[model samples]
Target: MHSEHPPLFLKIAAWGGVIFLHFPLVIIALYAFNTEDAAFSFPPKGFTLHWFSVAAGRSDILDAVMLSVKVAALATALALVLGTLAAAALWRREFFGKNAISLLLLLPIALPGIITGIALLTAFKTLNFEPGFLTIVVGHATFCVVVVFNNVIARFRRTAYSLVEASMDLGADGWQTFRHVILPNLSTALLAGGMLAYALSFDEIIVTTFTAGHERTLPLWLLNQLGRPRDVPVTNVVALLVMLVTMIPILGAWWLTRDGEMVAGGGK
Candidate 1:
């Protein structure tokens, strides 16, 4: 018997779809190496590393990059803590409105960015909370929690409750069981979740726009650069850098989360 493969037309369609999604990213990356600083001419007018040097030297861009890094780091940290707690609370528990609670937790990521942004903005105004670095971190954390929550809850569902029961029977307290037993099982999932949350927060624009009062994060900086044709090449370099930074974590998360046999004689 011969193994069945996808039809040739389907294979072609899949490749075409991948190309369609990635071709623009390739163009942006290519433009980063263009020698012509101002205009995007055909053939790129030759290639050089000048824009990279320029991007490195720009203080404003450096500041924006730092701000984005700070915000992403803070958001990811918050998400990991909160999301893990939420997963632990909801796991293996049945209650009224549980589904509703889960839906509400996912609302930030499920809704359109603009809608989330507007809603957050309105809430902040209502509460008299000024928008700034803290607000930006809070905004990013809102959606970031969903990523961590999804990864954690999925892992939790797969985890065997018998192990936790065994730990309890062995005189281990809740903290000890969680620290030794559950933590090991959840390490990879938490890592992948944190990485994904960091990536999302790093590149977020819409929610950041509403929450960031004077803080100019890297994405907002890129948006501001659109009006300057002379800085196009430099901006492209920055954009490429951002893509690479975000892509690594995302790819790492994907690799970590790939389907594989779970460790035997463990929670999951």
Candidate 2:
């Protein structure tokens, strides 16, 4: 009794949902090129690249962008190491408190961002650590690890353990086996996970709000720009840049992992 295609209403609803979600992004993009900069007007008066040039000349914006990129890079690096190791440990192991550990690993990302931010802030204060660049990197890493862990663990599930055994049986040492066998198999998954983690860290705002004392990431800069009505066009340009930076990595991750079932050493 199943139909070959979804009902017409379902299709309409799905498309409508897509548009509803993306329309704001479309408007932001359109406004980024608008010539009239006093305030957003109905039906853009003109389209020009003036705002893009203006944004490029702002030192504050440049500094915010550099800080964001640095934070995201460092956070993604930490996540890659910790997440891969955690996934490797939990993938085929049975141990006491294993489930608890897994849950804790994912807890940061599942909790509301504000809660995580507050918790991280309190922890830093308890440790007498000042909220700054390092704090922001650590806070971002907390959730970024979850992204990498999920991707790497999913890849591990599809990967064949027999390959590891075979490498060992062939007289390869632990490091050699990992380098030749495991790393190759995990390369795409790690890259995809790192990309996703980078994207997530790049646009994060809530956690950054609590941890970034006297330091402004791009998102924080954009949030502050909201108070300056004259900077609407510049804000739109910067917002569009944020979208592109985050979107490219996400799309790259999707492309890398789309055929996830066809993993190396999988079908044996």
> To one decimal, what is the Cα RMSD in angstroms of model 1 from the true structure?
3.5
Q: 76-151 in candidate 2: lDDT tens per residue?
A: 9999999999999998788999999999999999999999999999999999999999999999999999989988
Q: What lDDT score belongs to each candidate, Candidate 1 first?
A: 0.91, 0.93
Writing each residue's lDDT as its tens digit, candidate 1 over 1-268 gives: 7759978999999999999999999999988998755347866777789889888999999999999999999999999999999988898799998899899999999899999999999999999999999999999999999999988888888899999999999999999999999999899999999999999999999999999999899999999989987788888999999999999999898788886343111234
Q: TM-scores across all candidates?
A: 0.94, 0.95
Model 1 segments beyond 4 Å from truth? 1-3, 36-39, 260-268
lDDT of 1 at 78: 99
The C-alpha stretches of model 2 lying farther than 4 A from their native spots are: 36-39, 261-268
By TM-score, how accurate is candidate 1?
A: 0.94
Candidate 2 collision pairs: none
